[model samples]
Target chain A: DAGITQSPRHKVTETGTPVTLRCHQTENHRYMYWYRQDPGHGLRLIHYSYGVKDTDKGEVSDGYSVSRSKTEDFLLTLESATSSQTSVYFCAISESTGSYEQYFGPGTRLTVT
Target chain B: AQSVTQLDSQVPVFEEAPVELRCNYSSSVSVYLFWYVQYPNQGLQLLLKYLSGSTLVKGINGFEAEFNKSQTSFHLRKPSVHISDTAEYFCAVSEKAGGSYIPTFGRGTSLIVHP
Candidate 1:
């Protein structure tokens, strides 16, 4: 929705395969986040980047990794996909870290077989 | 650490009926409250937020929420809901920690409006 876009909106992959999701923002926001949405879990943060090359893990960082080599792009990688990792992923951007509303992008739905 | 709890997992109501979605949070320091709505196959959109001055906050689509400091709760309410109002609502809380704000979100409440 806001100038954010996620690539590969839908994908199906087998177990133990590597997958990467890309998030691109045209707003030039300083903060970007990766989150996963499951049936019971609303949205769990996987990783976040404060700036280019500055990344940190979130509550559900296990089995996932992230990289931000540029201000406009953030990448989420799954080294070995599992059935448990199948979920809808969303990317969000914020102008500030505190009290600022985070704008979300169109989600990417990934299914692991 | 901050955590948000949404009391209802799902609520069903008829058109033109009123609705209330409950939310509570636990935090050690001051916090900011927010409500977000997600329609089918869509990303979340901000409905309202309680930053500082007002305890009662009005948001888009005639929705409103009240922040209660004593009860540590922020509940969303609407007097008259339309069929188009059916969606999933999520509550979130953010607090400053280590010079950064970390937000914690609730599971979410699914609102089903029937004719």
Candidate 2:
């Protein structure tokens, strides 16, 4: 887990509901990323933040949003949760983007019914 | 743009047997390669990475991978395996995206170690 923690390890929600997952890191890393894991798809990046208040879209950024107000916290929000968005979400942190290995958190399992 | 491909979706091996997991990537620019292992109910852990200086990169738990530029591949290998070695492995590629680099990961290959 590398000093990273994801809140609400397990959650069951209804469709069209709003959900927010929080990732907190004690390492003070400069980079944070949000990813989803599903069967047949190892891990797909949803969004990433390079620095505080700086964010970028990833391969699968649709239906998801992210916010980074501080270096230790990166939040991922699903404005309107859908059944397709139900998956295990992982948060990763790294000191730098290049060459440096990113450390991942345990993960948050979100289920949309 | 960069993409990674892991040829096998699953690999089965016996204890103490050698095993190899194939990985290939396509990138327009120079890239960094990495291998990660994830156990059941656990987050991904870095097995090894190939940044520069060496074609053969060794990693934790007696795992190694070779970077073949001509083939556009980085395959992971281990001489002997244990039952604890069973896990899902992922291959990822990182290239310049703006001032930083973003990694693109393959689907993954599940290794089942049989006794």
Off by over 4 Å in 1: B97-100
List, residue by residue over B7-114, the lDDT tens digit for candidate 2. Answer: 999999999999999999987677889999999999999999999988999999999999999999999999999999999999998885442378889999999999
For candidate 2, report its TM-score: 0.97
Per-residue lDDT over A92-113 for candidate 2, one digit per residue giving the tens place of the 0 to 100 score: 9999877889999999999999
Candidate 1 matches the true fold with a TM-score of 0.97
Q: What is the lDDT of residue B94 in candidate 2?
A: 89
Best by TM-score: 1
- How many pairs collide in each candidate, listed in order? 0, 0
Give DockQ for candidates 1 onward, in order: 0.80, 0.80
In angstroms, give how far residue B87 of model 2 lies from its true place.
0.4
Pairs with steric clashes in candidate 1: none
Q: For each candidate, what TM-score against the reference?
A: 0.97, 0.97
